[model samples]
Every structure is written in C-alpha cells, then in structure tokens.
Target: MKLLETIMQRAQQDPQHIVLPEGNEERTLQAADAILAKKAAKITLIGKPSEIQALANQFQLKHIDQATILDPENYDKMEAYAQLLVELRKNKGMTLEQAQKLVKDPLYIGALMIKSGDADGEVAGARNTTGNVLRPALQIVKTKPGVSVVSGAVLLFTESPYGENGFVMMADLAVTPNPTAQELAEIAVMTGHTARTLGGFEPRIALLSFSTKGSAKHELVDKVVEATRIAKEMAPDMQIDGELQADAALVPSVGASKAPGSDVAGHANVLIMPDIQAGNIGYKLVQRLGNAQAIGPVLQGMGAPINDLSRGCSADDIIQMIAITVNQAISLKHNKDGILH
Candidate 1:
C-alpha cells in the first residue's frame, strides 16, 4: 500500500488524460473506475459507449457511466486519421483504403488518438497480446529520436532490494529479443531514465551478464562488455557498469569484491539483461522467489507514453499501470526535447 500511494501521489500531481483500449475487459473497466475516483488521471476508453457502459454497470464500477468512451469504427475523425496514417506510412505502402481499414482496430485508433493529441498516454493489453498493442503503436506513435529499439522494463519492488532505492528495474524483458550491442545500450539508457522518472530513484544501471568483468570469457560476456561500453558512450553522465553476474550486480559484498571500482556494481537501480530470455527469466525468478512486486514490463522508447499490461493482471495491477503511465506522460510533457539519451 505504501508503494501504491507513492506512485499515486506522483501521478496525481499533474494529472493528464490516459486512454485505455481494453475498455471491454472487466479489469480495465474496474481500474478505470478506480482511476477516476482517485482523480489521478482523466479516463478515455476505446470502445462503443453503449457496450462499455453496460459492462461498467455490470461490474458496478463507480464513475463508469460518465467515463469517456470512443468507438473506433464510428469516430468522427476516422477519415482524417486514416489520411494521417496513410501519409505517415506511405513509405511502407499504406494506402488510404488500407489505412481506413486498419483504423477499425481499437489499438490502432488508440494510437492515433495519442498521435493526434486527443490523449496524453495510452495503456492496453489486458486481453491483447503484446504485439497486438505494440504493432499499432510502433506504426503510429513510433520511437523517439536516437532510441531505435523499443524494449520492455519491469519495476520490481522487493522485500529486500539491491537498487539504490528499495526497487529494482529489469529491462528488455517483454519486447525485442537478441538486441544488438547498440540496441542494448539504448535500452539501458531508457531503463535508467524510467527508473528516475517513474521509479523514484536516481538510476545506477547495471548491464547484467553471467560473468563479472573478465571473470569468464564467452561471446555472451563479450556482448555485455560491448553493450556496457556503448551504454557509457550514450549516457556519459549516467552511472553504468557491468559485465556482472546476478549476484555481483545485486549483492553489496559480492559487488565490492568482484567489481571494486564500479559505481553501479552493487547499487544498481536499473538492470539491463543481455537478451530477452535472460530478462524475462530473471525478473520472474526475483518476483516469485524474493517476494517482489513486479509492476511493469512497461513499454519504453515509444514516441508517446503508452504502456502494456500482463493479460493476467488484476484490477489493482491496472491501477498501478495507469499510475506508471501518468508519470511517463508527465516526464514527456516536461521534456519534449527527449527525456533521456
């Protein structure tokens, strides 16, 4: 509850509109009710108003009757958005007819809504696959400059922690597999920025691997070493180090002995795994074995403040996701030039 309140307080400070495309999902609807009640964000649901309202009533979610709901199929700006999509993706062979057809998807429409400034941020995936949400956002919202690869980062609040704060962030967990060194560097930079902006921690990023620097020799260790170099080059002012094992990265005594001179050795707030496999598995292991709270797998490097949710997430999970999205939106709002390197 303390963790939830910390996020909620920050989110409500400069409230912004958040669009939810999974309006028909009961958890999403219930979360919307909680969001509205908390006054932490303005709610917009992407679905037919009648149908969403019916479900909202069925769930007995407060403020549901008054929540703004949009039907992608019948939105008044559908033609204009289709034209924009065509123009935006003309290099990809998007015809107006095809754009018009794609706009029928709530995901696409929600992306367009953010693209068109109808909303500040977007969240979905309660019932959709990650690609279902990511594809449209990638096509419509795109990536911020210099962030060529988008990744997933989950913020873990632990019973006992290794991050500078009491929380840890693991990256590339739910998106982008087998990233190149440059791509991994960009992901690390984004995760560090996310830790500061959303996780309330001054970021110390550890580029994680199976071995501490020069402790073992493998292509995998080489990959982490190269990535660490690029991450340093990318964000010179940021504290980043590693080619570190999980133990060396998170355990203070081990970090001190293994990588004695590194600033991020034992106090990393953000952990950038070597690849998606390591990231996905590492986060889940900590989440289950360490009694940690995993809040995201949040989509980072999108042009806007859109996020994805686990399909199995509860209503409380949705609320927290919205809070995270709000923080991302605020960070973007305050720094349009770029939130981080």
Candidate 2:
C-alpha cells in the first residue's frame, strides 16, 4: 500500500504515458478505468474505438473514453510508423510491405509508440502470450546499454517472518531457463536492483544453490560459486554472496554458521534462482503456501519500460503493474537514475 501511494505520488508529480495493446480485453478495459481514475498515468488503449466503446458501455466500465483509443487500421500515423519500422528493421531484411503488415499488430504499434516517445511504456500480455508481447519490444526497443540478458523478477510480499522485512525478490521465474554463470550473474544484478527499486531496501543478494559456501561440491554448486564471484566483481559495492542453500539465505543464524564472513548470507532480500524451474516453483510455493503476495514477473533489462501480464491477471494486478511501469518510466526519463539500474 505504501508502495502504491509512492507510485501515485510519483505518477502525479510526473505523469507517464502508457500504451496497452490488449485494449479489447475486458480486464484491460477495467484497469484502464481505474488507472485513469487514479491518474496513475495517461493511458492509450489500442483497439477499434467504436467496438471498444460499445463493449465498455455493455460492461459498465466507467471512464472508458478518458483513455485514448487507437485502432491500427485507421490510425493517422500508421504509414509513418510502418516506414519507421522498415527503417528500424531494414538491415534485418524487412521490407515496406512486411513492415506495413507487422504494424497492423497492436503489440508492434504499442512498441512503436514507445520507440517514438509517444508513450513512456507499454503493458500487455493479458490477451497475448509473453512471447507475443515481447517480440515487438525486442525488435524495436531492444535492450538497455550494458545489459546482455533480460530476466523476469517476481516481488513477493508476506507477513511471514521468513520474508526479509516482509519483502523479497525472486528472479528469472518468467524468463531465462538454465542460465549460465554469466546469465545468472545478470539475473542477480537485475533482481537486486528490482528489490531496491520496488521493495525500498538495500539489496542483500543471494545467488541460491543447493549448497552453502562450498559445503557441497558439484557442477551446479560450482556454477553458483562462479556466479557469485562474477556478481561481486561486477557489483563490488553490492552486498552479495552465493552458493547458498535456501534456508541459509533466509535464516540469519543458519547463514552465519554456513557462510561465515559473507555479507549476503542470511540477510538476502533478493534470491537469484539458477533456472526457471527453481525460480518458478520457489515463488509459487511462497505465494501459495506462505500466503505471500506475488506481484510480478516484471520483465527486466529492457531499453524502455515494458511488462507482460499473466493471462489470468486481474484488473488490480494491471493497476499495480501500471504503477511499477510508471516508476520504470520515471527511471528512464530522469537519466536512468533509479535503484533499478
């Protein structure tokens, strides 16, 4: 709630323009109404205006028209956007006709808006797969400078004492599978930054493994150990340690005993999972069993702010994602000067 308030204040102090590609989806429309009501940011819905309006009236979603609605078929900038897309993809063997066809996709159009600064960010995936939501961004928005890999982090919150300060970040749950040492290091950096940005803490990062400080020796543990070294080398000022067992990462005494002289042992607020299986299963376990609130698969390391929603996400989820996206926009507009980077 405090985070939401902070987002609201930031959004009000400096509004961001957000584009939603799944404008025809009921949940998106519902969220648009609430986000507009909160003035969380200016939202533009990508949909056929007439059909969107008719559905809004039928569903009784208020303030539908408060957000701009654009249909790619009839948008005034379609051709210009097509030309731009062609220019962007010309080296990739794209043609004017191919660009024209791709521009018809709402996701591409929304991505174009971001590339052109027409919008500060884009959020979609309620009605589309993560791949569909991300492809256009990969093609147009690309990755931020110095970011080699992109990962997704879920910020989980709970009242359980196991959670550090009632907050924690679990990484690579929605993206990246079987990461190498370098990729794992990147995920750690991204998750650490995400924890600080959204959770309001100095990150104590734990690169998790089944072993604790070489208590066990295997290729898996070796990978974590190597990742820890790389992460420390890359982020010396960050309090990070790795090759930690899950309990050692969370329990202070266990961490002290298992990983003596380590800064992140037993004090980690961010967990960098080695692979998607662990990352996905770990977050779900905390969310479902520990009764923690799982807030994201917040896609990280993008050139501009963009996010993907679970198809089952609620309107409230969308609103929260919009808030997070706005914070990301703030980070970008102010010289990438946020805890996230």
Candidate 3:
C-alpha cells in the first residue's frame, strides 16, 4: 500500500482527537468535514459553533456538524484551561489574568486543549502566520522530553529507483536555519524516527555535506562528521553515516566508491541536510524537477503532535496533515509506552 493510504488506514483503526484553531477558515472547515466523513480522527474546532456552522452551510460542507466546536468567546472550561496555562507559564511571571486573556485566542486555547489531554494533537496556520501558530504550542505544549529543538521533515515520494521503493525523508527543511552539530544530530535522529513511524521503513540516515568522508576538509564538513558521531551515540541502533555528498548518500555506486564498508553511505532513505538553505533548495528541486510528491515539513520533537500548514494550503492538504498528525500522536504514545523503540 502507499504510505499515505497506510497512514490513513492506521488512523481509521485508532482515531485520535485533533484540534484545529482555524475553525472559522473555509478550507479548514472543509477539511474537518472530510475528516469527519472518513472518521480519520475526532476533530475539535476552536471557534464559535454557530459561526462555524453558518460557514459550513455557506460552503455546503455537510459533515462539519459532526466536529466539536468550542467557541473561544465562551468556552465552558475557560477558567480551567486558563489555570493550566498559568501553571505552565508561572515561572515566566505569567499571571492568571494574562492567561485568561490569552486563552481567548483560538490558537492558545487549541494548544491548551492538547496540553490538557482534551485533544491528542493540533493542526493550524491556514490563516495565521507560522510564528503565531507555533508560539502557543511552544509556550504551552513545549518540546518533548530530552528534545531541545523542533524540526520539520518532508516525506518525498520520488520517481527514483533508490530510497526504499522511491520513498525518502529529508529534514530541517522548514525550520532551523543554522543548527549546531548537536542540534544537527538531534535533527538526524528525529528524522530517522519520523521515517520509521510515518514512512514505514527502517531509516538509513545520511548527514549530508559537500564532502564525502575526509576527501575534503572544512569546518562545515567537520560539523557533519561530529553530528554523525553524536547521532550514532544518540540512537546507536540506527544506521547513520555522514559528511557525505548528495551522490554518495543516494547513489549505490557512488556510495561504494566513496565510503567503502559504511553501513549508511549509499542506502540512505533519510537525508538530513546540514541547514535549512540546503534542505529547502534540495526538496524543492526534487519536488519540481523530479516530479515528486512532497508530503510535509511534518513538525517533529514537540511534546504533542502540533503541525503548521502553509497559509496557501488547500483543503486536501489539511486533510493529509490531519491524518499525519494522528499518526504522529499514535507513534508518540507508543514510544512513551515503550511499545516502539
């Protein structure tokens, strides 16, 4: 089965509660209607119920009524959620009044819902900026235990014959402009995890660079080599190698020629680019020139699964992201329970 089909099936088997802060947006409501029809997840919309319903009617979205709409204006548990926020932010001198006022924002309330376990995951940014969407999540939900930074990965369905049946994952594509060696190591490990859980394949990760092995010496190449070592220490069982050029990472012949006897030099299914510039340029080049279907910038290392969408996303994009978030939530639960390593 296709990767997305498998993810959708898994979501159907064990649906999660996913909250959408942009409930009043037309495309989000449309996607919510579709998700309700598919039973992919239980959706909580953070907006006025009546207004959402009216917009649904305007769009002729039949299944929007099935979504649970919690109005930010008059949520029943406002005080409770506000208190939760105050507790979370009290160290930062956040007062109850400040928390109460902030909770009235749909984005803040949606994140608080996830933080309180009222929802399992969150999807937003249809009408909001990336910074605005992530602010509440970072403030409330925070990063996962032992994780310092949040990174984004894209699951590229390529037409190439390499990379686990033409499926590959690349990371640091949407966030983190110039990560240090430690942060790069974390990104590599987290991207590998995303590959296993969402891509349904064992990850052979390559920390990409301009140099393959010690063929060239530079501070940048040194950084990748250090990251590779740190990543191996982090996830010792994972297949990771690096300071490899793009060709050595993806091409079997080049990998063999460049880095002989290395486990991950040639057969890498997860490519961890050194920085956002390389990642952004690389993914786009493949997506446009190679005609690959790029699925994410799936946000990783959050305390809960909270994904940000491009403001220009379509309803179908939202639907796919919702399913992805559900699967991430499931994976996180399994990891916490030691069901998956």
Candidate 4:
C-alpha cells in the first residue's frame, strides 16, 4: 500500500474528532475538505464564517458548512471562553479586544476545543510557530497528572514490497532541547505508552546512547543510564533497558555482542534518545535517507495527546496524526481505569 493509504486506514479505524486552527489558510481549508470527504470525523474549523465560505467556494470544495466554522466574532457565544482567554493572556499585555483576537486564532481555538471536550484532538502549526501551536495547549490543557514535562515522538515505519511491516518509535525529537535524566525518563515512559497505544504492540524501550552499558564515559551516557533506571522503577511492568548504542539497540547481532541476555536491546520498538539533537537528527535521517515513512514528532505527555504538524506536512499527515491522537486518548482513558482496556 502507499503511505497515504496506510494513514487513511488508521484514520478510518479511529475517526478521531479533530479541530483545525487557522482554517482560513488554503492548506487548512484543503485539509478540512479532505477530512470531510473521507467521512473521517467531525472537524471544527476556526475562522470567520464569511472568509471560510469564500475560500471554500473559490476552491469548489464540498461539506463546507457555516456551522462547522468557529468564528471568534460571535462574542456572545464566546463570552465565557473569551473571558478565560483574557485571563490567560493578561500577562502578555493583551487588552480584552486583543485577547479576543488571540482566542479566535486557530491554535488557541483548537486548544480550547480539546480542553473543553469539543474535540478529541487537534492538528496545527502549518502557519504558526511551534511555540504558537504549543503555548495554548500547555497553558490551558496543561500536562497530565504527575507529568511535569511534555515530549514528542515519531512513528517510523518501513515496509517491504511484499508488505512486511517494521516500526520503531523515537522520542524527544521536537521538544525538550536538553532533558535531565528525570525528564528523559518521563519521555521514555510516555513514548513507550504511545508506541503500544498507537502502533499496536507492547513496547520494549531502549534508552539509546553512544555506549552499551558502561563502555563509554560521558554525561550523556550517564543521563541515559539514570533515565533507564528511573523508567524501570516508574513502570515496573514495562520492558525497558538503556545505555545502548544505536547499533546495539537496532541490530540483533550487535545487540548480542554488546549486551548479553537483554530483552530490549535488539527488539526494542521504542527508542528514547539522550536528547533532542540526537533524536531529531536520527529520525529525519531514517525518514529522508533510509526511506522510512516518518509519521510524527507527535507531541505526548500533555493533559492529552495533542499533536503538532510539521509546517511542511500534507493533508495526509494531519489525518494520520489525528488517528494517532485518538489512539492516545483512548489508551489514556483506558489506563485511568487502572487496567488495560
């Protein structure tokens, strides 16, 4: 199957309710059209009704309903939410009108939708900075209980001509520039949970570093070692090990030589990097050079699994991220029951 087909399959199964911020943009409008045409789920678009309608007509796109467009101009409808928005932005020197303008912004609107259960998830950042996309989510939706840091992961998949599938998840690629050991552990645990939830397998995590065990000496290696220990303690039932090199973590023969009798060394599906620099570079290399289909830098460990899109992302990227977000949300709901569902 093509990459888009794989993404569509996941979206169809989950059909996550999604909100599109900045829906007035051409790309955002196109994405909303695609989602609606696919009968994927309910999609709320943030924009002025007339502006959105004009764009839809210009593009000859169907399913462009006025009700689906969330207009910030509807002050009466937005009164309570607008007030909350003002309170949140008061420190930024925003007056009531300015706060209202910001609230109408697609990022802020989408974040509010997620916070209020108006949407299951959101996809944004095509025309916004990473900070712009994440700020509202952090401020309003906040982090999950006991989760102090927000991190991200990419779902890397490789498929052969005959259709065999292989996947590896990498974390801290888009968030946490220089993570402490505890922060790294949080990333590890969060990434592991996401791998299982979205990728459909029990995650075996490898805390990747430049060395296997104590073979190399560096603060980075020490960080991975401590993170691995912390992750194990935090989720005792989780299968995780760390301080392994890339080759050891990914190659069976190399893993056997480097770390004897380890469960996660070669078979690990979730790889928690020592920091963002390595994780970001590693996943992109796999995607651009190794021909793997990279599905995210999907943000995790927030109050919910609200994901941000690459400004370069296609409509298909938004669809896949929504499906992944659905999986994360459902898994979180099930986990809160104190048993796997």
Candidate 5:
C-alpha cells in the first residue's frame, strides 16, 4: 500500500481529536483543512484567530467548517485549569504570575486540553524543541500509574519481498540522552506497550547494546543487562531480552547462532537503546541508508499519546502522526476499559 493509504487506514480506525500547535496560522489552517478533507480526525489548530483567518483567506483555502481554531489569548475556560497547573508547578521555582505566563503558552494550553478531556490526543513540535513539546505533558498530563519516566518511540517501516511490510520500534531516541539501567527498563517496557498498541501485536522487545549475550564487556553492556533484568521483573508477562547487538536482535541466522533458545533474538519488534546518541543515529541510518519509512520519534509513556513532528515535516507527515496518535488513544481507552471490566 501507499503511504497515504496506510495513513488513511490508521486514521479510519480511530478518529479522535488532534491538536496542532503551529507557529503560523496559515500553515495550521492548511493542516486543519487537509485533515478534515481526508476525514482523518477532528482538527484543532492553536494560534491567533485573526492571523489564522487572514492566512486562510490569503491562501484561497476555504474556511474549515468542522475545524476548531483556538487562540491561546481567548481560552478563558482554561483559566482555572491554568491556575491549577501553576500551583502544581510551584515547586519548580515558578511564581503564580510566572506559572500563569508559562501556562498561557500554546504548548501548555494544548496539554491542558488533553488533561481536561477536550482533546483525545495532540501532535505538536513543529516549532518547538522535543523538551518543550514534552514538558507541558509531563507537568499536566503526568505519567501513567506507576510510570516514572517518559521516553520516545520511532516506528520503522520497510518493504520486504512478496510485497510484505515490516515494522521495528526503537525507543529513547528523542527523550533521554543518557538513560540509567532503570530508565532503560522503563523505556523498554513503555516501548513494548506502544508497539503492541499501534503495531497491533504482542511485541518482543530487545534491549540492544554492543554485546550479544555477554560476549563483550563494557559499562553500556552492563547497563543493558541490568535494564533487561529490571524490565523483565517489572513486566513479567512481556517478551523481552537484552544485551544483544543489532545483528543478533534482527538477523535470523545470527540470532539463532548467538542466542540459541532466546525468544526475542530474531523476532524482536521493539528495541530499547542505551542512550539517545545511539538511538538517534541508528534510526536515521535505517531511514536514510536502508530506505526505511520512519514514522516517529513519537513521545510515549505519558498519560496520553502526545507526539512531536519534525519542523520540516510535510502535511502528509502531520496526517500520519495524527493517525498514529488516534490509534494510540483508542488503544489506551480500550486497555483502561479492559482493566475496569
């Protein structure tokens, strides 16, 4: 299938609300129009109304009828919510006025929308840093029950022979720079959950390192070992292994030889890296050199599936990320229901 087709498939599965925190109104309006036209999801563009309208007019784009354009300046209903947020973050050395000022930001407001159930999920970071995109979510949306750290997941796609497609997930590429073993374990568990949610399968997670089954000795390898142990203890039902090199994790022959009886040796769908430097470089290498279609450095482990888009992302990228976010939201809701039942 084509990229657009895959996007539409995911979008049709869960048409939740998607908030875009763009800098300029015209671009945001254009995005809103595209999302609505495609019947992808409910689009909410956050910016100044007048500026957005002017850009819509200038671009000869019809006003998005179904779209809700939000201006941070006019979100009066969120005042109480913002004040609460200020109080919550007071320990971070922010005064009430300072907190109020920060909460007025589009990023903070977008996060509040999710927290308040006004939006199902959000996609931001076109003009914001990864930290900027995640900070508000961390502060307001918070982590899930028992979740201590937030991480990132990238969906790597490639076409195999016979027209089949494959997916591999990498974690902590955009979030933690130097994750401790405990943090690595958290990332592995979170990435596994995300993969199962969006990729629609039980994920075999591999905690990747330079060594495979203790063949190499290094601090990083030790970290992966401890992380794999922690992850297994935390998620006893999850299929996970670690201290494996990429070749052993991905190649059937190498895995069969290196890890004789391991479950995740060659069939791992989720890979947790030791640090951001490796995760970032590895994903990009696969995308650029190996010609894989990389969908995300998507933020995960938060209360919701709030995502980030590269500033150079196209309208199609926004559409696809929105679809992924919607799927995540639905899956999360479904899991919650199952637990309650």
Candidate 6:
C-alpha cells in the first residue's frame, strides 16, 4: 500500500482528537466533515458556534455535528487557556492581559488545547499565513525537548524506484533557511525518525553536498561532512552518509564509483539538502520536471503534532495533513513512554 493509505488506515484504527483553528473556513469545514465521516479523528473546531453551524448548514455537511465546536469568545476554558499562555510566556514579560487578548484568537485556542492536553494535535493554515499559524504553537506547545529547531519535510512520491518503494523524504525544505552543521545534524536525525515512524521504513539518510567523500575540498563540503559525522553520532544505529553528490546518493552505479563501500551512498531514502536554496529548487525540479507527486513540507520536530496547510489547499489536502498529524502524535506518544512501535 502507499504510505498515505497506510497512514489513514492507522489513524482510523486509533482515532485522535485534532483541533482545527480555521473552523468556519470552507475547506477546513469540508475536511472536518469528511474526517468525521471516515472516523479518522475526533475534531475540535474553534470558532463562533453560530457561524460554524451556519456554514455547516450552508454546505449541507451532515457530519459536522459529530465534531466538537468551541467558540473562541465563549469557551469555558478561555480564562484557563489564558492563564496557561501567560505562564508559558511569563519570562518574555507577557502580561495576562496580552494572553487574554491572544486566547481570543482561534489559532491560540487550538494551540492551547494541545498544551492543556485537551487535544492530541492541531491542523490549520487554510485562511491564515504560515507565520500566523506557527506563532501560537511556538509560544505555547514549543519544540520537542532537546530539539532546538523545527524543520519541514516533504515526501516525494516518484515513479522511479530509487528511494524506499519510490518514496523519498527530503528535509529542511520549508523551514530553516541556512542551518549550521549542528542544526543540519539535528535536522538529519529528526527526518530519520520521521521516516521510521511515519514512512514505516528504516531510514537510509544521505546528506547531500556538491562533493562526494573528499573528491572536492571546500567549506561547503566540509560542512556536509561534519554534519554527517554529527548525525551518525546523534543516531549511531541509523544508516546515514554524507558529503555525497546527488548522483552518488541516488544512482547505484555512480554511488559505487564515487563513494565506495558506503551503505547510504546509493540506497538513501531520505535526502537532507545542505540549505533551503538547494532543497526548494531540487524538490520543485523533481516535482515538476521529474513528474513526481510531493506530499508535504510536513512540519516536524515539534513538541506536539501541529501542522500547517497551504492557503490554496483543498479539502483533500487538509484530510491528508490530518492523517499525517495523527500519525505524528502517535509516534510522539510512543517515544515519550520509551516504547517502540
């Protein structure tokens, strides 16, 4: 089965509570209704109760009733959520008045829901900007412990069988424009974990560079080589190799000739580009010219599963993101309890 199909199946089997901040938005509402119909997740919609109901009625959505809608202005936990937000941001000199004002916003409410353990995960960004969607999450839910930066990963579904069953995961695609060697190493480790937990495969990670194993000597190549060593140390058991050229990383014949006797050189399923410049250009080239389907810029390395969608996203996109968030939440729970799933 496809990775997405497997994810949806898993989500249905163990449905999680997902909060949708853009409750009255058309695509979000449609996606929420579809999710309820599939029993993929229990949804908490944050918006005005009357407005949500009116939108549901206008769209003739039957499953909207199955979702729990919390009005941003009148939620019972409004004061509690404000208090929590103030506490979280107290060191930043955030006053309770400021927190109360923010709690009225849907995005903040949704994030606070996750922070307060009222929800398992969150999916938003249909009508909001990426920065707007991420602000509350960063302030409240924050990054995972020991993780300092958040990176974005995209799952490239290609026709060529180069990666894991024709699926390759690329990272730092949407966030972290120019990461240092240390941050790059952290991105590598997080993306590997994402592959194992969400992609349902052992990760063979290749940190892409212009040079292949000292064939060329430059500071850029050195950075990649250092990142590779750091990633290996960070995740010693995982398969990771680096300072490899793109051709060496993907093509077996080229890999063997370029980086002899390296495990991940030819068999890498996750490709960590050196910077956002290379990553964004590379994925788009493959997506458009190579005729591959790119599934995400799935936001990883968060304390909880909170994903952002494109403003031009369809209901189907929202549904897919919801499933991705559910799987991430499950994976995070397992890791927290020291259980391998």
TM-score of each: 0.96, 0.96, 0.97, 0.89, 0.91, 0.97
**What TM-score quantifies how close candidate 3 is to the native fold?**
0.97
77 Cα displacement, candidate 4 (Å): 3.3
RMSD (Cα, Å) of candidate 6? 1.9
Model 4, span 1-341: residue lDDT tens:
35346446656666667777777878778777877777665687887888999999999988767237777666344656667777776787667887667665667777776776778777788788789888989977888877888888887886522111477778989989999998898888888777666666688889998889999899878888998999888888788999898888877788899999998877777888888899888888878888988888888878766788888878677766665666666666677311211
Clashing residue pairs in candidate 1, if any? none
- Alpha-carbon deviation at 290 in model 6, angstroms: 1.4
* Error in Å for residue 138 of model 5: 1.6
Selected candidate, larger TM-score, 2 vs 3: 3
Which residue runs of candidate 3 sit more than 4 Å off their true CA positions? Answer: 336-341
Model 2 reaches what TM-score against the true structure? 0.96
Candidate 4 similarity to native, TM-score: 0.89
lDDT score, candidate 3, position 143: 82
Decreasing TM-score order of the candidates: 3, 6, 1, 2, 5, 4
Residues 1-341 of candidate 2: C-alpha lDDT, one tens digit per residue? 56667766777677799999989888888888888887778999998888899889989988877899999788889999999999999999999999999888999999999999899999999989999988999999988776778789988877867556777888999978899998898778877766666665688999999988778889998999998898887777778888899999988899899988888777788889989999999889989998888888898888888999999999999988988888888877776422233
RMSD of each: 1.5, 1.7, 1.7, 3.4, 2.9, 1.9
Which tens-of-lDDT digit does each residue in 259-301 have in candidate 6?
A: 9999988888999999999999999999999999887788877
TM-score of 6: 0.97
**136 in model 6: Cα distance from truth in Å?**
1.2
Q: Per-residue lDDT for 100-127 in model 5, tens only?
A: 6766688988888888888988888767
Residue pair clashes in candidate 3? none
Per-residue alpha-carbon lDDT of candidate 1 for residues 17-130, written as tens digits (9 for 90 to 100): 999998888899999999888889998888877889889778777787667888877878899999999999999999988998998888998899899999989999999999
